[model samples]
Target chain A: MRAEETMNKLPANPERATLEGKNKFLGFWFFLGGETVLFASLFGVYLGLRKATNGGVTSQELFELPLVFIATMLLLTSSLTAVFATMSLKSQNFKAMIGWLVITVILGFSFLGLEIYEFNHYVHEYEHTIRSSAWGSAFYTLVGTHGAHVLFGVSWITLLIVRNFGRGLNLYNAPKFYVAALYWHFVDVVWVFIFTVVYLMGKVG
Target chain B: MGSHQNDSVSKHDQSHLDIHHKIAHQKELKQHIVSFAMMIFLTMLSFIAVASEAISTRFAILFILVLAGIQAAFQLYIWMHLSHKGHQYPTWGIFFGIGVAATCVAAGAAMIW
Candidate 1:
């Protein structure tokens, strides 16, 4: 029984307690680093074309602070929940970790719902489609890419939870969960910039 | 490589390691709480800076962008544990990636003119 307990409950760094775990952990961070550059390039393009609105609705006219604010709060809170999930993972509390992760997924879905609503509102009310202007293209590409990322993250986490439902937290699976949590946080980090650069900056003019 | 062997090591060895891990976890938990509060506050402050009209719009944009930077750093280091020990390679990978990102952003910006 003691040996069984030991097998499951590894160390605080359960994700990196083995050589394979170490590789996965390091590789994921490096992947995140690469992702950083990918997003940065998009941001650069968006900044350059933010004002070329081709006689359609301008950002200042379209962006409503309240909706964006609610979205930000939802995502920010979700990031915190993911952190809680990671903490629970460290302590080997499988149920609590899943509980927190589920909350994280819920918040992510809420944010995605708001984003979809925001996009639909803009399209129907203002006809602000991607082809409307250069500004429109940049805006959609940058924010849309981010929206795609959120979609991917939600799918990723939900699948992990479902797939691992039968298997308790073990050495093989902890790294996967840890990296998923990291990716979720990275998603939040990206949104921090998007809200600041895209939404908040767009509202300024 | 032999994590299985490591796992099979005597229970005495693990209990010894567990004490240190418990202490480290306590510290990490406190850090998470403090950073979460700080992040919320920063987000609020950025929004307030924009809504207040106390500053020029351009200045508010710049100010909030800087706040975003700080928030990202906090998330990366504290929440992601990028600053933790044994992360030296990840540290290099990220900073090098940042260097490339900076160059990419700058190169893209120059095409604006």
Candidate 2:
């Protein structure tokens, strides 16, 4: 009888509780930092090679400020939805949290769709393919990397939502939800830079 | 002695989960919503800045980039919860990584420039 009670009340395995979760959290943050540098390098390359447009489509001519601005707004709002989901998690409101996450995923998908259409429009309409010039290559590389990050975030969140739909909130799943929200925020941060460096700066310079 | 006893009693009370804590959490959620609204407004302002013909292109670019930087900081600190956490080591690690990346980008640019 004593053994049964002890087993029931055993503190959550520290390996799973503090150590492993903390390691995953810290490692993910480091990974995001690495991503920042990856993006910074691409931005630098894009800046230098920006003028080597080979007299093809130029930033001033090709970039449409209005469409990019709308896309930016959509992504920024989705970041907020993810925040609400995290808040729900903190309050142990599992249903509310899941609801917010689903909303975030939808917003993310819309943003991705818009980006795909924008890229296609630019390439087909403006004759600005990635293979056109150094500028085109750098442009696609930097912005494409960001798009890939968004796609990854969407997939990550979707899987987490489906996996946890029936599990409910417990110590085991709380950290998973938390990490997914972290990834969503990281993607938002990257979009912030992409808007500034690629869209805003391109139009200006 | 009596006050010390009261302090311990209150501490015990604080340890117990209650509805007040949930209410406070909801209030915090409202603050988060307000922050999000502010960010949305700022994003729209940037769009206006970009679309307007009167604004000098150079100033428009600088304004938008600076605004994006501010928005990024807001998302990281508020939404990501990095600011409240003990993030000193992580901050240093990421910044150092950025430094190395900057060097690589500079070198690559120089080679191709």
| Candidates, DockQ | 0.53, 0.38
Off by over 4 Å in 2: A1-17, B1-16, B98-112
Q: Please, what are the lDDT tens digits per residue for candidate 2 over residues A1-205? A: 2332332221222112456666776787788788778877887788788888988988889888878877987888889899999887766678999999999999999999999999999888999989999999998998898899889889989999999899787656777887888888888888887787777777767
Number of the top TM-score candidate: 1
* The 10-residue segment with the lowest total lDDT in model 2 chain B: B1-10
Instruction: Give the number of the best model, judged by DockQ.
Output: 1
lDDT per residue (tens digit) for residues A6-85 in model 1: 46556556898778989999999899889989998988888888888999999999999999999999999999999999
Q: Model 1 reaches what TM-score against the true structure?
A: 0.93
- Docking level of model 2: acceptable
- State the displacement of the C-alpha of residue B37, model 1, in Å, after optimal TM-score superposition: 1.0
In DockQ, how does model 2 score against the reference complex?
A: 0.38
